[model samples]
Target: MRPMNNAPLDTDRPNSLIIAPQWIGDAVMTEPLLRRLHARGERLTVGALPWVAPVYRAMPQVAEVIEFPFAHGGLQFRERRAIAKRVEGRFETAYVLPNSLKSALLPFLASIPRRVGYFGEARVGLLTHRLKNPKSKPPMVAFYSALSGESGFDADRPQLKFSDQDISAALARQGLPVSGYYVFAPGAEFGPAKRWPAKHFAELAASLDLPVLLLGSGKEAELCDEIVLLSNTANNAKCLSLAGKTSLTEALCLIAASRACISNDSGLMHVAAALGVRQVAIFGSSSPLHTPPLSDQASVLWLKNDASYQSPLDCAPCFERICPLGHTRCLNDISAQRVRDLL
Candidate 1:
């Protein structure tokens, strides 16, 4: 219950708002929507990540953040109900940004009178404002804007809002030398199709005269190691792998330190984009227009195919885990030389 400015709290209807975005990247991308809500006299309460609740909790714009115990698709019935009860009678309007069949259940059961979301996965009865998924919705920002009926969403890089305190705290924790270093996050949760070969990353790191900071989660430790060990760097100094070392908040601080970053289209890339770091974010499964990195300086490197190996596969950007075709030509075809040129 942070006291936002005293103003009328409704859209010619009623006020008090709570919104739950489907994922971390989407949550970051919806900063403009929160800003717009603030403009129209609405208090913001967000549902945050399952484990990394502290990151968004410290965010200035987020007055309240309740972390769901379940991961993205983990539907624990009792747990969801308890969370819903906690949220019940807390807000008059709840916005569900996810399009899944079950994304509406919690909000619906919570008894939030005005639930707003898109008409997807046959959840028509759940949403008060069932926005038609627009034909011209290229950027994901537009999708977030539609949540609160905000029109003409300017397609920019992802919109993430953080506080000076958050920035300060994050920076103080990571004491990395900032002299000419480029952060490289070459992992994607979208699975193997999105991952450019680890060896290629090593190749790219060798070419760079400056420091290359390798970043990812604990799950990506082995991959990061393979990249670091195999990479051929000139002098004695090696690429610093901070994959398992820092939390999400610490990573944010380190990402801000670098001159630029090269990442696969993943959460780290989204965060880098939000920080407005100069980025070269390569994309394969996810198209640039659909989910471009937030920074204007971010460039997406995609695979080009000729007669020999046409597209990643017939179902190239299928956006699935473990490529349907055994070989991941889309990412494999993108040579380290091509990435080197971008760097």
Candidate 2:
């Protein structure tokens, strides 16, 4: 057994800080690492951006979640230093998840005794223990799991928990019944190259007897509205665009209580998988081999893997925000019926 700093391994549960990833999918994938840390008797506190903080709440292992008010892109040095003062001497070790030097700066500013993370972004001085970044991108779950400094958790599936009361409240607020509706998360934060066509989503919605609820951020509300308009006018399917309305916790609750969820290779796709909800994840510019939904109930659809798919996607898994070739047949070629059949 590994000793907890200066304490006996069996009795003392050392205080530990975890610097969480900004994206919801990446945050969800870090659950295995958190779980392992908890099992080894480490009390965990997660520091995360406001957008991703709710994800840590779903994890039973997290002792606390501190929401950071940092904006995207720029390094907020003064803000980090201020926040670091509040957390100083509270944690013995800090696990920095994102490779950016800014992400590692907080723990260093807090004067955390030991900081652990992957080597990248000229942060050699920031982290006390650094793992070499893999030359090739590995599965996201495995990539995060390796942060635990332990092996053999590569195949572990991420899991999240929510009380029935919470789920019921969300359903009541949304006027949805348990298992009476299907969730369609048609937006991808990455870009158009990763999203399945809105028309295909509309077609699938029109085919379903149950109501299809489209969920996403405010930025994606317009896209969801397009699906609703198309499904209603073209095929008279009952589709509601609830994209910008719900809170992240409400969204998680809704997904947990739904019959099933269908989504692009995005954050909500991982949320559904972590919640153990039946989900069909559509992959486009990205490869499932790298960031697949880590759930047995998840059925991934990637045309790149289909030998029967005509004009083999030799250019697929480009990992691009938009198709460099301008066509994006990778997502366009996957028929609505194919997705409907999986559901």
Model 2 root-mean-square deviation: 4.5
By TM-score, how accurate is candidate 1?
0.82
Residue-level lDDT for 78 in candidate 2: 93
TM-score of each: 0.82, 0.95
RMSD of each: 4.5, 4.5
100-165 per-residue lDDT for model 1 (tens digits): 657777888888888888878898887777888776765777777767675777754444545666
**Local accuracy of candidate 2 as per-residue lDDT tens digits, 185-231:** 99998899999999999989988889989999999999999999999
Candidate 2: give the clashing pairs.
none
Q: Which residue runs of candidate 2 sit more than 4 Å off their true CA positions?
A: 1-12, 234-237
